[model samples]
Target: MNITPCNTVSLFLPLLFFLILLLIFFITPFKGNHFSLFVFPLSLSTINDKNITTTQVQVQQPHQPNMRIKKMTRLDRVEEGLAEARASIREAIRSMNYTSEKPEYFIPKGSIYRNPHAFHQSHIEMVKRFKVWVYEEGEKPIVHDGPLNNIYAIEGQFIDEMENSIGNNPFKARHPNEAHVFYLPISVANVVRYVYEPIMSKKDYYRDRLQCLVEDYVGVIAHKYPYWNKTNGADHFLLSCHDWVPSFYECNPQLFMNFTRLLCNANTSEGFQPKRDVSIPEVYLPFGKLGPPNLGQSPMNRTILAFFAGGPHGNIRKLLMDHWKDKDSEIQVHEYLPKGQNYTKVMGLSKFCLCPSGYEVASPRIVESIHAGCVPVIISANYYLPFSDVLNWNQFSLEIPVAKITEIKSILQSVSRNEYLKLHMNVLRVRRHFIINRPTKPFDVMHMILHSLWLRRLNFKLTNSQ
Candidate 1:
C-alpha cells in the first residue's frame, strides 16, 4: 500500500468530516421527539415506555385548582361564618332577660311608728301613718283664707284635697304638744332653688351656679352636722333623686369631701331607712291605697295607652301633648292615672306606656312601666335607662330616639304583628325580675332615708372603736 503525502491528507480530512457530521446529528433536536437531543437514535420501545410512565403519572397525580382562587374562597367562607355568628350573638343578647345586681333587703312591715315628740304633731302623725309629706313653702296664710285657700295649704288644703280625691289619709293622729320643730337654714333653701330652678325651666345658665350650690349646701350641712368622726350619715341629707349629685360634684371639687358626693349618687339603697316618726305635724298627709284589679274581667285591649306624671317642670306634659296631637288616633294616649288606682292592673290592660325622664334625666317610671308588663316607649334624650340591669329593653319595649319624634307613627306601623306580640310577651316574662315591691316591703324613699340614718349611726360607732 504505497501512499503519496496528498492521498494521506485527503483520507484524514474525510474521516474528520464524517466524525463532525455524526456529532452534529446527535446534538440536533429530533423533529417529533424532544428527548432525541439528549439520547441518540430514537427507539420505539423507549418512547413507548416513557409515554406510558408519563401517562400514569398524569392520571395518578392529585387534582388542584388555582392556589390563589382556593385561598380566596376559604377566606370568604370564614368571613361569612364570622358575620353570621356576630348577628346570632346580637340577637341572643336582645332576647336575654335583665336582672338587678344589687342585694335585696326590704323594710319590715308594721314598722311605721308615730314619734311622740314631733313638733308638727299632726304632720308627724300623718307621716308616721302614711309615707307621704307635703310642704307649704311660704309664710303667708294663703291656705287659711281665700278662694284658693284649700289650694296651697299643706294640712287642710292639700291634705283635705288628697283625702277627698284619693280616699286614703296618710296622716297619723298625734298630740300637738309633743311635736318638735327642726328648722332648715334659709341659705339651704336658696341654694337648692338656685341649682334646681334653672334646670327645671330648661334655661341655660352659668355652669358655675351648680358648683356653687353644691359646695354651699354641703358646707352648710356639714358645718351644722360635723362628721360624727364615728360613722357615715347616709340619711343626713335624704335626697329624693340620688342620681343628680354627680353633675353637681363634677361642677365643684370643693363640694365633695372624701368622695362623699359620689356616694350620694349611688343607685343602691344600701344603708338608708325611712324616718320612724317625724315631729313635723303640719307636713303629714294621707296617701291613697288601691287594691289590685282583676285581669280576667278587664282583659287587655289590642291598643294600649299609658301615661307618666310627676314631672317638676311639666316637660312630660309637653311631650305627651305633642305626641297626642300628632299621633293620638294612630296610638291611643292617656293621662297618667291617679296613684290610688291599681297601677299593675292599669298597665296590664294597656299595650304601651309613655316613659319620660325628669328635668335632669331618666326616672323610675321606666322600671315601673316594665314591672307592670307594659311595653314602654322611651321619650328622653339623655336617659341612661338600666334595662339590662333589671329588664331587657329591646325585648320588652320600643326605644324611640327623642330626635325622631316625628317618626313615631311610622315606627308603630312598621313593626310586624308577630314581632309586637313577641315583644309584649317578653315584657311579661321579664317583669318578674323588676318587681320593686318584692324582696322588700316599704321600698319607698322614706324607708331608704331611715335606713341610711341607721347606717350612719353604725358607722360612727365603728369609727370610734377604730
Candidate 2:
C-alpha cells in the first residue's frame, strides 16, 4: 500500500521469501533412502535414557542432474559413530583426569600404569562409547562354546560374557550400524576340540584342519556381509588362548594381517605384533569358578626368597630348572611340588614368584602370582605381558632374562626390604586387572581385555577406508 520504492522492495522481499519456502517444500524430492540420522551417547550413565547427540544427514537426490554425492551406507554410519568416539577418547586422554558421578572402586595411579591419566581416560571412554557387534555366523561348540575350565578358560569366558548381553553390558551393540568393532565369535579352542585329531601322528594335519575351519568361518562372514570386506578384516577381531591362532595367519595372512587378535600367546618371535594385536591374560578358572583364591599373604610373612613349581614345558623353563632345581634352600625351583604342599600356598609364601615361559609365552602362573600378592618375576624372551599397553609390568613385576637364571636368587636377595615392599604393594595394586570376575567388575581381567581392544580400535580410522 506504500507508494515509496523502499516500501515496494520490503513487500516484494517478503513475497519472494514465501515463494522460495513453498518451492523448496513442494519441488525438492525427498531422498530419505540416501541418508540416515545418527545418534551418539554423550555420557556412560545416560546412554540408554536421555543424554545423546543426534545428527541429521541429508543426501541430495541422485537424479537431480546437477550434483553427484555418494549415498550414506551402514558402513559410513558405523564409521561416523567410531570417528566421534575416537575424537571424544582423544579429548578425554588429553584432559588428564575424569570425574564420574558413579562411584569407582579403583582409580588408576602409581608407576604400575604406563600413563595413569591416559589409561584412566581411555578406560572411561571405553565404558561410555565402545560397542562390539559379535557376528552370529558360526555354530556352537566350534563357534560359540569354548573350554571354561583349566588353562584355556579365558577364551570361553570372554565369549560367554559377550554373548550374554544382559544387564549393564555397555559394550554390546544393539545394531551393526552403531558398533565400533565387529567380533568374530569363533573359538579356536573349541575348533581344536571339534576338529583336531590329537591321536594322529602328523600334527600338521590337525593344524591344517584348524586353519581351514577359521578360514571358512571368516570367508562365510566376509561373503555374507560387507563389513569384513569393507575394511578387509581390519575392524573385526577374535579372541583365543589357543596356541594355534597365530598359525592361522599362515593360511590366510591377508585376511588376518590387520585383524585384531586377542591372544594369550603373545610371543613376538611367533609373529605376535604388539601394535595390531592384543596380549590377553591366560586365566585358569577351575570348573569355570571365580579366580583362584587370593591368598594375599602379607609382605613380611612371605618367607621364601623366590619360588617356582611347574614341569619344564619349554626351553626357558628347562633352563630355569637346570640351574635352580633343588640347588638352593632359598630358591625353591621344583618340577613338581611335594604331594602335601599346596601350589597356591607356596606362591603366597614367596617374596617373588618365578613365571617362566612354558610351551607358549603366556602362563596362568603370572596371574596366580598376582593373586597371591607375590611380585611376578617374568623370565621369558619376546613375551608381551597382558595389558602391558596400559599397565607397566616392570613397575610391579621383575623381568629377568633367561640367561640370568643363576642370578634369580641373587636378584631377589638384592632387592632391599623397601624395594621388595614397593614391588609387593604394586603387585597388589595391579592385581585387579588380572582378576577374572563372574560379572566382570571394572578394570578386571575381562574389562581390561575389552579395553585393550578398544585401544587398538582407536588406533584405526575406520572412516578412512578404501
Candidate 3:
C-alpha cells in the first residue's frame, strides 16, 4: 500500500537501527573482566631495525578458550618451582667464581669433572631444590625392594635411599605437588625374577614376556593417574640393571619414547640413547658385603703394568683374552687367575686394570679398578660409562678401542711415567664419586645417580596443565 514519505522514513530508520545493533553485537569485543570473545596470550620477541628492539605480541590460538578460566594446578606450582630452580642453577653457573670454600664437604675439581664449577653448582642447586616423588603404587620385592648386593645393587640402593625419610634425605619430595621428577621404583631385575618363565630352547621368549610386564605396569599407572598420559612418561623414570630394560620401549614405543631408563647396560648397540637415558655404574657386591677393600698399593710398589681376569662372554672379551692372555708378563690378561694369586690384591698391585665388556657393555671391573686406585683401561664398543654426563673419564681412565686390544701393552708403555702418575692420582680423587656408601654420602655413586636424573629433569619444562 502506498504511504506518505514521513511514515516510510520512520519505518526505514527503525530497520536500519536494528541492523546496526546486530552488527555491533557480532563485532564488538566482550567488556566483562571474566569473559572475552578472544583472549590474547602475549610472547616476547626481538626485531632488528636500525637498532635491536624487543616487543611483545599476542600469540593467537585458533581455538582460544574463555579468558576467565585460569586454572593454577598442582602441576603448575611444580613447574614454577622447577623454573625457579633452573634459573638459580644457571645463575650459579654464570656467577659463582669457584666452589664454596666454607663448606666442610669435599669440592669437585681437577681434570676428572667435565666442568667443575658448573657441576658443583648444579649439584648444589639439586641438593637445595630438586625433589622426586616416588609413586606408591606397586608393592614389595618388585616395587620397593631390589637386590642390595649384586651388579644391580644400585637399583635397590637408589630405591631405598629415595624412599627413606630418616636423615637429611634431600631428594625425596614430601608431596607429589612439590616434585620435579617422578620415580617408578619397579625393578626390572626383580621383574625378570618373578615374571619370566624360562622355557628350554627359546632365549627370546622371556624377553618378550618381560617387555609385556613393563607395558602392563605402565598401562595400569597411566590409567590410574593422569601424570603418565600427560607427558607420555617423559618425567617418569625407571631404574633397571637388567639388559632387557631397553625392550620396554619396543613393546609400546608410544608410551615409553620419552620415559627415562636409568640402566647399567648403556650399550648404544642395544638402543640406549644417552640424550634420553642414563648410564648407571654396575657395582657388584657379594650377598652382604659393602665393597671390595680399598687396598690400593703405592704407585712405586705396583710392579705389574696391567691386569684382567674375566670369563669370555662377548666377542670383545674373547678377543681381549685371546690376544693378551699369558702373552705378556706386564699385561697379565687372564681367562682365570692361577690358584694362589688374590684377585683384589692383584688388582691393587697393578698400575692399570683392564675393563673389557662381557655380553653387555658395562663391566663391574671398571668400578673395582677405580676402587683399587688402578687406572681403568676401558676396552668396549658402544659402552657409555656411568656418570659420563658429569665425570671426565678420560682423566682417570683410558678408553681403548677393541681394535687396539693387541696394542694395549704398547699403549700403556707409550704413556710417560709422569702421565701414568697423574692418571693414578686422579683415580684416587675420582674414587669417591664411584663408591657405593650405605646411606649415600654426598657425591658418592648413589648421589651421582640422583644428580644424573636431576640434570635430565632440568632439561624439560612441563606445561601448567595437569
Candidate 4:
C-alpha cells in the first residue's frame, strides 16, 4: 500500500526475495547443501482455476553442497558418517557384489559369508569411517594389558592392537567425541590374574570384588566423561574372552545390557545377547608362542577320520569322554595323546576335529581346529560362534547335538566325501579370519571383531531412532 511509484522498486523486490529465502533456510534443517522440498502435488483443477492447465507435480531437489554445515560436534559427524555407511551397505546388499575392488582387501566371497556384498561393503565402511576411543581411566595388567600366553589371549591382543593401531586404516580415535563407540579397556582375564590372584585361597571373595571393579569403572567413566551417561553406555564396548565375563551383567544389569560385550563365552542361555553382544574367537597362545601352525596338511593327507584330545571340564565334554574315550578306533577321543601323538599334528591329520565346550560355552578347540585346517565339529548348545553375523558356520563346520555324543562316529561317517571336501576347502578359505597377525591385516580376527562392533553400533543407532 505504501509503495506508490517508489524510486527503489527493483531493489525492494530483490530484498523481499532475499528475506524469503533466508526465512526458508532458517526454518528448515539442511543435510549438507542439497535437501528435498516437495511441491505437494497440485491437481490440474487447482492450476486451471488460475487460467492454466492443472497437473499434479512432484519435484526432487538436486545435489548442491554449497553452504557450510552448521557447527557440528564430533559425535554428530560420527553418526552422520555411520548413517551414510548404513545407506551404502544397503546398496551393496542390493547390488550383490561378491568382493571389493578396494586395495588391501580380501574381498569376501563363497558360501562362507551370509551376504557377501553386504559384509564386503560393511567392512569397507568400517575401514573408512569406524573410530574407537579407549578409556584411559584404568591402569595396566587389568586395563591396558592381559594374558597373551593363555586361552584368553584375544583380550590382550585386541587391547594391545587398539592401543597401538597405526597404518592406512587406523581405528583409534584421538578424541572421545570423534568415536563411534568407546571401549572400556578392561581385561577380565587380567582382572582375574591381578585382582583375584591374591584371593586365590578364597575363591568366593573375588566375585564381589569383580562386581565392584566393573561398577567402579563404569561410574568413574560416566562421571568423568559425558559419553557413558549420554546413551546409558549403549555406545560403549568391552572385549573379554574370560569365562567369568557373562556374570558381568549381574554387576550392573542395565548398563551391561545396554553396552556391547565382546566375549568368547557368548552363551545365549547364560545372558549373552547375540543381537547386542559379540562372540570373539578365543585365540589360544601358549607360553610366549603362537597357538598352532598357520597351515595344516591337505585334505587328501588327512588320514585320521576324526580326533579329539581335551580334558573333560564341563558336562558336555564329560558326556563326550564317557561315550567316545578310547572306545572307537576310527574316532580317536583321547584323555592324553598316547605320549607320541602331538596335538597339532593329530588335528592336522584328522578330517574332522571335535570342539566340545569346556567350563564355558566357548572352547579354544574351534579356533585350534580352524588353525589346523580341519573342519570343526561343534558339540555345544547355546554357543554363538564368532562372526556368525557374516560368516556362515554351517558352510565350514558341523554341529552335533550333545545328546548324540555316543553317535559322533555315525555322524562323521554320514558326511559324504564331496561334502567333506567342500567343508575342508571352506575351512582353509576362512583361516585368515581366525589368524592373529602383527600390525593387523584386513579380515583377520581383530578386524572381524571391529567389524562386529561396527555392525552392532549401526543396529543400536537404528533401534534408538525407532
Steric collisions counted per model: 38, 0, 0, 2
lDDT of 3 at 315: 96
With candidate 1 superimposed using the best TM-score fit, by how many Å does residue 402's alpha carbon deviate from the native?
1.7
List, residue by residue over 354-444, the lDDT tens digit for candidate 4: 9999888888899999989999999999998898888889999999999888888988999999999999999999988998886778888
Candidate 1 similarity to native, TM-score: 0.37
lDDT of 3 at 235: 78
The residue pairs that clash in candidate 2, if any, are none
In candidate 1, what are the lDDT values of residues 298-360, reduced to their tens digit?
Answer: 223734443444433347546655666434544544455455866556556666666654453
The 10 consecutive residues of candidate 2 with the worst lDDT sum are 33-42
For residue 151, what is the lDDT in candidate 1? Answer: 12
For 133-240, candidate 3 gives per-residue lDDT tens digits of 888887887788787888888778778787775556877888776877788889887877776645456773547777776777787887787667666677789998
lDDT of 1 at 408: 65
Better of 2 and 4 by lDDT: 4
Give per-model TM-scores. 0.37, 0.83, 0.83, 0.82
Model 3 off-target regions past 4 Å? 1-72, 98-104, 165-168, 197-199
Model 4 TM-score, all chains together: 0.82
Which one wins by TM-score: 1 or 3? Answer: 3
lDDT of 2 at 55: 23
The best candidate by lDDT is 4
